[model samples]
Target: MVDTMALLLPFGRASRTTSPSAQHPAAGLPADDEVLLDAPDDRLGPALVAAGQGSHRAAADLLAATRALGRWDHRDRYVLRLAAFARSRPEWVQTWYAAAPDDPDVLLLRAQLAVDHAWGSPARAELLRGVSPLITAAARADDRDPVPWRLALDHARGSRAGHTYFGELWEAAVRRAPLHYGCHVAALRYLASSWHGSHRECLDFADRAAQDAPADSLVQALPARAALAYLNDGCGPGVPPERLHAA
Candidate 1:
């Protein structure tokens, strides 16, 4: 597994009452992305269970996950929070991973989580059926090429074999575009599969996208390139082919 840089989340949300399931007042509540976004790791909110100090195992686990997410998305603080929660209670990984917004870590994360959860083909199918419309509507409305491309990449990586299966649509999704999301990730995957793209070629793709692609998309595409290098073919580091977030 690629060791993604730990993403430091803002903090855990506070409410007087904790859930019985969570074992603390902040238990079962969504994580605080805003807090993580507001400051660096040393400055993360105190509301989070002090390092090694949660009443419930879940709290500690969640704190760990958010801390893990500190370096990733500035926008999906909620997601970082969820990541912490999943680390605490791994069973929740699938549900929350699927919920991750279209961003750098989420797409690959959902897939890894789905695989970890053994979501199976049927589950993959169910998810694809649901997201297809959203894609269709988005494509019709948004002129931006990367949006749907991101969605397609999400579908391919995140599908379940049985429970969440979406069949060959994953492959088709990539082929249908105006080279949306560009082909960097796919290229990386192709290269990883058989060393298709030259290292310079992969870097060039990332360079073009970084300059022209939406700021948000650059995050997703970049990590995907990392996955291609590592997971797709077991090539390199946890870092994105291009490190956009840490910059």
Candidate 2:
């Protein structure tokens, strides 16, 4: 949901490279943990520090600001980081929930955490189904946000949802933000799931989405991600070497 799964290096791995300046130039150096996706924001640094000290107020305020500004991109990244943090140190998030159960931002965070937790379960589909209400609550909380729809798309895939239902969700997601990277990637994954072993169709979908998206869009990377998936999976006639090279 954050980015392609292949792109998620271990948390501290990127910081080990010596060329931090080349990787991410900063007016001031950010802490190792603060470095994310090779681009660290000034706001997330202090927000993370606040979270580390067992406070959710800063995290809440940061998300609220992003939401108030309709900064969906910033909201997506913050949700991923906050959910990751909450998974390990849950007390702060639990406190936040206790204090403001109806808060839209809090609901979004909780929904992400819930789905993430469900993903590891043996009864994944059943668990995912149970969490539908959380996803719905988050979606209803803010109609302008596509991140919840991204979450819903992931949930639909996990729950083995029918194509019509999945397509409906996809429509709603893209309508909110036509080129949202998270939603596009989610749709790609759904396509891959729905048409198992049809690598060509999946790759075509990825390529079209990437081409239609902006040059800087993460959707541009979807084709490469599709190629990787085909290579990793040996169930079908693997994508040709030339295709992989092209990707």
Candidate 3:
């Protein structure tokens, strides 16, 4: 078998040799007052403001536009932001659902919200299992969208689903968007959870994914993400210092 670690070594060396300024010219720690955590973009800013004022039209239109344009990445980001907002203030989403019970955007938001809610419960696995229908509804709403499949991958992990089921979800997600970073991350997390003591497997998977992804694709960061997860796990066999650096 080809050595996955060998494949990742060059990337690791490049990362170490490259100056931080060359990689990210503007990279720096902002002042506490200047930092804006998870600030919405110009398009989303107005939608969120309107939602705060008891309006879901802007949010709906925004999501619809993303879908129409096949902007799955933007759609995924916006859905998460909207879902987070809804968790604290659900009136608008409830109103949206009542108005358009079958709207794809509404269904997507509902599924995300339900998963977020269930994720924090003590009975997390049980609650997550019950969320399958909502996820299915969202997935069915748009056969072309991969965000729902990404959500499903996460759902499967949280619900303690078997490898076969998770593999099926992975196939569906990649079929929609082969290089989708979100789906890749979801799959990575599932691997980490399922093979808790097998950090090498996770790293190998990450290396393979990064190898296949384009230079600018976010999936290129999968190896780094996997390394971080392994470090955080604390229970895995010690990964070599060079390998960690390369990842």
Candidate 4:
């Protein structure tokens, strides 16, 4: 509602390495405590931006201050911030989408947020219907770069065929061991749902992670979850992915 589009460039310009704890006043809060405790070289810039746009006044100001830096150095600040706001603040999404309905990135961000925040709310597919093409175009524009696996995961939830469709990607991504290594949960869910539904693969991932995962551990507790899923699905006193990988 506040003409955040023009601010996109500034968002892009700010360094992603800033300390959100220092930038966000609520960094010390429980949920944000992680952001405050860890002063990583790269902060969750996108999440911070969204927090700012949503209600985190400190996040907003930090985003604004990031603008003072030159544009040439800007990253995906607006995109990240818009995404963050859409997640915690759906009202912001409705408002921004109304003003710039055709903005693909905005629509995609909303789609991702819808699913992430869907637990207590409505099903998120409809939100995707209106913006599907926009998201497709943005993906094309970015040369099929991954927007957010949540978008793919949304489709994966719709049908058995959908599971098969994304299975290969999930497998390949796991092998690549990406940046947000933690997000593998989205992919793991899809993989576990596929026809083959090999719990071993996820187990392998967890095991490998145990061996090579960062000190901050992405899916540390994941092995147990995978084991439970295996048992629930009647996999026979199944071996947890972590243990299987471990052994």
**By lDDT, is 1 or 3 better?**
3
lDDT of model number 1? 0.37
The lDDT values for all models are: 0.37, 0.75, 0.77, 0.43
Model 4 agreement with the true structure over 106-126: per-residue lDDT tens digits: 555555454445433465455
Give the winner by TM-score.
3
lDDT of 1 by residue, 33-151 (tens): 31223332332334233321432334334334543553223223333343343344444434333553442334433433333233245566565656655455433433333334444
> Which portions of model 2 miss their true places by more than 4 Å?
1-40, 193-197
TM-score of each: 0.31, 0.80, 0.82, 0.47
Q: What lDDT is obtained when candidate 2 is compared to the true structure?
A: 0.75
Of the pair 2 and 3, which is ahead by lDDT? 3
Ranking by TM-score: 3, 2, 4, 1
Error of 2 at 22 (Å): 33
Among all windows of 10 consecutive residues in model 4, the one with the lowest summed lDDT is: 1-10
Evaluate residue 123 in candidate 3 and report its C-alpha lDDT on the 0 to 100 scale: 91
**Number of colliding residue pairs in model 2:** 0
